[model samples]
Target chain A: MKYINHEELLKMEPQYRVQVINSLSGFKSANLIGTRDENNINNLAIFSSVFHLGASPALVGFISRPDSVDRHTLRNIQQIGQFTINQVNADFWQAAHQTSARYSDGECEFKQTGLTPHFIDNSDAPFVKESQLKYALKLNEIVPIRLNNTLLVIGEITDILCDKAAIKADGYIDIESLNTVMVSGLDSYHTSKRLSRLSYAKPGILPTKISLDGKS
Target chain B: MKYINHEELLKMEPQYRVQVINSLSGFKSANLIGTRDENNINNLAIFSSVFHLGASPALVGFISRPDSVDRHTLRNIQQIGQFTINQVNADFWQAAHQTSARYSDGECEFKQTGLTPHFIDNSDAPFVKESQLKYALKLNEIVPIRLNNTLLVIGEITDILCDKAAIKADGYIDIESLNTVMVSGLDSYHTSKRLSRLSYAKPGILPTKISLDGKS
Candidate 1:
């Protein structure tokens, strides 16, 4: 086993520290955040930090570095009050990954990466047409993490588009069957194989593998 | 494809909405958070909401619903200001998931789930002995998301313990090689297969596959 103390971690090469620290959190969601400015220029950026915040209001949150390449995304979300979170799948993950590249101001990642941007329901933000599972969100809040000057961009899920076959009888979406990929560290992409969906946990009762149809 | 608008989502059965909304975030890290009260009572809980907040200063954040079964974990961290995040692996993911069972107050999840807690370096928190990669952290800040009444508990990495061979030359840990599992929705667990590690993205230049050793 290797043990790295805080001091050693701080002193390691900067890039190395980033990879190590980022990977420490384990696997992350792979999603392309789509947005558009008032000028109607579309923007797309791949984000691995997207997380489920709550379900009652159907909130989603993703970390945004205001000073990073994501500034356009953060800016557009603020300007338009709408954006899309599209899952990065196995088929177009390369193009999805390419969206992270630092594009020039006003440049459209959808155009640069050849991913089609589709609009629906008078929404201001564009959606990646290739994404198998995607959703539209209305900007709800931008809470700053003062420690690092990063913003926690929270949004309310207002709409969703997914393959009907993926939604099970009990509401579990079989994302693995849709080929939605995951990410780790700064660059690695992966696909998953379901191990099991155990039954609702309760004390003194061991959880048994539950099928997607709600059968245990 | 099926479309679910905001109204339809709001009208969903609460449990069904929870499952559907939770799965929309794509895959999530599966982790066992270990904490201990001032009286030395250990607490273990499964958390899939953990996310990477920042790389510099080595920050990690996880959402905690103040009213949920995770109150034990939140209370323990408040009392001790230290906690450990352990990566759930395929070998013991079922045991890890079992930690989420709501035991009565002061009941140690470690004992309830039969998962051993290992302590080191005078730390108040315990590390799961079964975890292949784990790290100790110091509580930095607790930011409340007033929108949902959930708290984002931020912590700084203080120490790390992992298998020596998993750390690649460029510092990206091969977590898949360690068999670390991922979670989706609430109960489903997954193991990953590497697709590819792409090179750093650059505008107008396509990203190519990079090897574990950092060679493209």
Candidate 2:
């Protein structure tokens, strides 16, 4: 057993956890691809942590490291007050992850990753053309966590672009079919599998299986 | 490609996607167990999501969910203004998950799961006797996340208590020897495996042997 203070906790090595909450939701690979500032033209990165915070108002967020690194994605989101989150399935991971490089602010990751960037009206960000489950979000608020230089960036999901049938009657996104990957401890990625579903689940209750792998 | 509004975006069926955050970085499965509330007299079921939230004033949080059916955990925390979070090792999961059942208030899960409960000073919540890691968190603030009626409960960690030697010089806890289990998805649990220890992992470079899974 061990106990330590805040300073001690900070001393721990940072885990290189990879993948985000995107793409694993099926449809297509390359869930997010966007350009950096207009002048610097930097290339951004791809991740799966993009999550829906709420539905009524439509909000989304992704966690990122603090200012220690000049991340282009956060910069673009801050400067334009908007950015696009593309969808990536099994097909686009190679291209999507390619965006993780630290390109000059003037370089466009969209071009380097070989992804097509298209713009939508009434929005400041561009969308990924290849992603089947794409959307645009306007930066709403940046809630800085007290953690060691980590920020929980929350964004309002302004527009969602996806297949109508891909949605369910109960209002849940079916993402297992897209051959999505999940993030594990520090840089490890794993292909996700649908285990089960529940309107409500408790222990000892025979949990019924409704394979969420998108096969259905 | 499909673009939809709020109603349409939520129309998609929710899928079970689990990713490891490397947050529970202590001796796995250690906690102080204690009963909570007068009405929900049942033993309070708790788990570790222990991660750093802040440092200067000392803030931390654990990710806790409402009891699948009746919301015991949330109610307990809400009613008493305090509850202890206990750890379950690679061995405690069966009993830990068992506590998820809808036991009547006053029903002790400690009794049901065979876990020994130990009380602390001036506190009614008893710490789990068997856990290798345990800590007490005063009610700071609870942020309810609106995700598919699921709440991502965030608690401001006030005071943390652990075994001193559990932490190593590299600034990480040597929790692997404690035989703690990590959760993925819903029911899947795994033990710690040290693939490699990195020297200094920045954006482009990472420590070696973090995990052999791939492209780490």
Question: Best candidate, DockQ-wise?
Answer: 1
Instruction: Give lDDT tens digits, candidate 2, residues B1-216.
Output: 555654544553343111111110111222323546766464656443334343333344444545443366667666776655555665665566566566765567777678887655645556677766555555666654444344444443323444556433333344444544544323333454432332323234323434232323
Chain B TM-score of predicted candidate 2 relative to the true chain B: 0.69
Q: List the residue pairs that clash in candidate 1.
A: none
Off by over 4 Å in 1: none
TM-score of chain B of each: 0.98, 0.69
TM-scores for candidates 1 onward, in order: 0.99, 0.58
Give lDDT tens digits, candidate 1, residues B1-216: 899988899999998898899999999999999999878888899999988988788899999999999999999999899999999999999889888888998788888888999988847799999898999999999999999999999999999999999999999999999999999888889999999999999999999999987788
lDDT of 2 by residue, A1-216 (tens): 444343443443443101111101111112363544656454456753455444344555566665533367777778878776665655655555556655555557677767777777756577777765667677777765543455666666666676556544433455444344433222333343332342222544533334332222
Q: What's the DockQ of model 1? A: 0.89
Task: Encode model 1's per-residue lDDT on A115-155: one tens digit a residue.
Answer: 99998884789999999899999999999999999999999
